[model samples]
Target: MPSIQKPLTKRAWVRLPSGRRLNLLDPTPFDFEADDLALGAARTVRWGGHSVWEWPLSVAQHSLTVLAIGEAEAPRPLTAAQKLAFLLHDASECLGVCFDPISPLKPFLGEGYRQLDQALQTAVHRRFGLPADLPPAWKKPIKTADKRAAAAEAIFVAGWSLAECREALGIRAAPLSADPLTPIYGGLPWEPWPARIAAERFGAALAGLAGSMP
Candidate 1:
């Protein structure tokens, strides 16, 4: 069970596996169950050049790829714990509504969303059996992978012509490479891959780490 302080009414509300039913209009909050909220959030968060039909690059997909990149990009091997951290880094957005850099809701979200975002992040890490905090070195590279995925998405999945993406999004067209098993823009409604493919890829990377242990 996890909770966030409802800013408008000043009460605590439990966010269940499903992401629904908060104390938006109530004074005293109650618990609600809605796991699909995270999945919906994953689909809703859009970057520039959005399309209802085109399979946009999802946070879930980016997260999975980041984990793959982390394993490949690590100077030596990465611990299981490190790999898990990369996989779950954006899990917070699963709780709060995902917003793009230019989305208007971002500024309007204010303090309440920020607090809820932090709470969900911590909860997701704990749920995955990862430490609540991530290492400083892992932070920059994971973010680089995130951006790299975004760059790829902007060019490939989001239907932005390379020149249009470069001029509008300021994202350069970079070479795309990753673990062979990791899916690249596998399918639309991208959240499914996390519970499906990402879990396996993460496990394989961790196994590799263990084998390299001295």
Candidate 2:
């Protein structure tokens, strides 16, 4: 067998634990690995790491929060694909420096950022058998769930008050008073996990979801 050719040093690629290189500028469905996404998301800090707890909140934890809120409030159970979509919503951000830029900063960065994000999202969708354009039925629940999760994180994890999350953060919904994951994980509600635990849990979750897909 021939040896695999290495990517050029100048390309926008990051090496993963699986010994694969994901090219950010031109990512493909085949490039995503569960563990890579998990570890990357676990290291990515939300809200600039301004946390009340000793450890900062990771995107992996936030994704689970979004999933929990989405699932719990729905009239019926969300399908595995739908849940996976929620979990991987920000998977694109896991590609590089593990930095999750605040939503407010996107406007200043302009179109290129959005284009790249969309490209990666399309790849993620295809990799997991989701439609490139997600279902319209997903609109309301995901929007509401995502907002509530952000508000809860702001108040409980990031040292913000409900008033601040509303007036300043522009999150109109009332923050969740209780930890959504408490019944399942049994930790201090809304407290951030260490990166290693977050990564392992996220990896396992992704595997379970993928395995459940028909």
Estimate the TM-score for candidate 1. 0.61
TM-score of each: 0.61, 0.92
Model 2 per-residue lDDT at 5: 97
* lDDT (10s digit) by residue, model 1, range 29-109: 122222333353345344642543434445555666667666776888877677767766676564434444443456687
lDDT of 2 by residue, 1-214 (tens): 9999987663588788788888888889898687888999999999898899999999999988888888889898889998888888888888654668899997877898888888887887898888887888886688788888888888888998778887898888878888888887888888899999999888888889988898
lDDT of the structure predicted as candidate 2 = 0.85
Error of 2 at 154 (Å): 0.5
| lDDT by candidate, in order shown | 0.54, 0.85
Q: Which stretches of candidate 1 lie over 4 Å from their true place?
A: 1-9, 12-45, 52-56, 96-108, 172-214
